[model samples]
Target: MVTRALIESVLTRARERSRLLTDSVDDGDLVAQHSPLMSPLVWDLAHIGNQEELWLVRDVGGREPVRVDIDALYDAFEHPRSTRPQLPLMDPAQARAYVRTVREKVWDVLDGHPLAGSPLAENGFAFGMIAQHEQQHDETMLATHQLRSGDAVLVAPETPDLGGTPEIDTEVVVPGGEFVMGTSVEPWALDNERPAHAVDVPSFGIDTFPVTNERYLAFMDDGGYERRELWSERGWSHRREAELAAPQFWEWDGKSWWRRRFGTMEPVRLREPVVHVSYFEAEAFARWAGKRLPTESEWEKAARWDPRSGRSRRYPWGDEDPDDTRANLGQRHLGPAVAGAYPAGASGLGVHQLIGDVWEWTSSDFLPYPGFSAFPYREYSDVFFGGDYKVLRGGSFGTDAVACRGTFRNWDHPIRRQIFSGFRCARDVQGEQA
Candidate 1:
């Protein structure tokens, strides 16, 4: 199904998104580091171009290198985010010109190359990979905009409201059994999501909707942060060490809580799923609610498995791609739609907001699936396979559809709160108190 036209369109769309995010701010802002957690926006711009050139122009097309001298400068592994601003990164004008030149060459490679034979080119996998890569950075850049300190620089239409909260059930039972966990047929699936396999997940009760701001506020009012008993040993330690109080960007006014969204201050919408909570924070909140974070498998089952059909879907709503009606994705809205807003996007078992809103943290660590193998490069996924990273399923509002899906996996350090992340709670079906 991956045709030359489709590949071109995907790549074009990715570039447009990348440009929109970068062009929103001035060159000075682009070159400055908004957070130690992320690289300067200019670094990301050139890095995106460098990766495209490395993978497509050189590796796939066997074309001559473009600006081989600057490769080291943009090599992400060579420079950490904290040190990136100190490095001699490309100026905005130079970075823009460099990427433009590289893209022109890439277009020639794409038009001349056949989309077959090798695994990288077969079904246009490499092109799709590059598109996904750019989109991932686009999401990262959007997060940088959120972290930036200044006036609001970016804007998007508000997410659709379901008028009022829908009268939906609060929880749903995934009568789980064996389900296919990963993908073998998805043309663009990355190494971590490859080699489809079966996983037997026990039945569990998962929240019908993600934990909303209203619900999380209840936890805060009840002293969720102060109660050490609700947190794991390490989580409790991190909570105290970081002096964690509220979710990142949240501030308590004299009357109510307000949050900074992309440099704009607004009252925290009680109906929206709370974003920017760390994995530790999500864990603590789940414990306080008398529930537990679902394991990676449980989250996937709740989002993808249809018990009646004994089949797994490509997304929560089915095999179709995401749209405005399905989920709050592609930065279509600056924030999550009100919880229970996307009724049509609910999973087979009636779990709502499972696909997008915020990246939902799971109890599982980032680990390889059964019969996993590194493809093309080990640095992509193999390097981070361990307990230090917790698996986060589903994509956030800032996530692009090209880089997200039912099996798509995201991971981060347990204490990372800068990334847009939230959680839904689950409990075992058998005699587990909730």
Candidate 2:
């Protein structure tokens, strides 16, 4: 049953993150330009909240607000990012109040429809649209935080001292077989994960934990960037073009490595999961370590457990939201935890941190399954395919739980490294064919 809990949590977090902005400028800054991709923080905050209310209440529940001013207040079309500066803005207090009111209305509607299914039952595609839309905005918010803080190279947050021993090395070997990939049941799945179908993959062994800073650092120390042999042709080209040396936030301070995170500089934690890497970077590091990335099929197969055989839930650990002792998400500490911090989040195969901490890059290209069909927003998937894009799984520190799903697929070019992306490694068993 649909509940307002997830939506409410997102709004609350959005407000908290926004309040972190050092700039206390009021509504006048809402339409002011902060960056090429970011609109005014105030404007985005109000618009996103209104977006939730509009879809969940007005569009889905067939209810209209007495005040139609929101249509103009949060109208994104006429007041596009390009023309933000020209739009009249709302005061911060006013905008915050509006967001609260909209959230209340959305919750009221959601409460009324306790048994509401996916967006389909309420507002058709509108619910999904708003959800996806807000996620994109959330991404923008993270980027804006970096931009505003003048921290172009943010580092992963320090891992808290959680006393948990790493699971002794355990491996899951999924036999080569054909299984259905993509969403089977109707879901708020993005267009990219649509048109589920069967795909066969060879057997492989995956590490239980994401590659850690200590592990990835070995590649860097071994000249992973300077060594062209480890990279794909495209990757090498990107490396050369971007003047690759090390992770975006990493720097050799002569004595030790240091990283820039959340507008602050700090020493690199060797045990934490390596964040701020691109698909290409992950691939290069994997190759250097004499391993390869798991294909999406392989990744999913290892993550989802079959109850008949005592396998756990679809998520790496099980069907549960992350908590402080589990995955490092929802700004738990404002950054990633140690790579092996959460054994509870491990898959049946003992793969740890598969659901959160940092997104893991996969070997598979961003292509649709067989019989793929576009969802409501065609741009979501069809726009990105073999066009030199790659798939990433799990969610990052800044990602909300609603966006964190085992099947959720994220894509990016092989070289861009502004996100909190990381990866794990997979390899064929000793006797299996590669």
Evaluated against the true structure, the overall lDDT of model 1 is 0.90
> Cα-based RMSD of the predictions, in order?
1.6, 4.5
lDDT of candidate 1 over 1-434, digit per residue (tens)? 88889888888988998899889899889989888999999999999999999999999989899889889989888888899999888899999998998899889988988888899999889999999999999999999999899899887898998535765337888775799989999999999998899999888999998898999999999999999999999999999999999999999998999999998999999888989999999999999988999999999988889767889999988999998878888888899888878888988888888888999999999999988999879889999998599999999998889899999999999999889899999988984432
Q: lDDT value for candidate 2?
A: 0.69
Query: Candidate 2, 243: how far from true, in Å?
Result: 1.6
Q: What number of backbone clashes does candidate 1 have, counting pairs of residues 3 or more apart or in separate chains?
A: 0
Per-residue lDDT of model 2, residues 50-169, tens digit only: 777666677677787634676686776656676765566676777777767776776676666643555455433455456666765666666566545443433345566463656433
TM-score of each: 0.98, 0.80
In terms of lDDT, the best-performing candidate is 1
lDDT of each: 0.90, 0.69
Report the error of model 2 at residue 219, Å: 1.0
lDDT of 2 at 367: 85
In model 2, state the lDDT of residue 199. Answer: 66
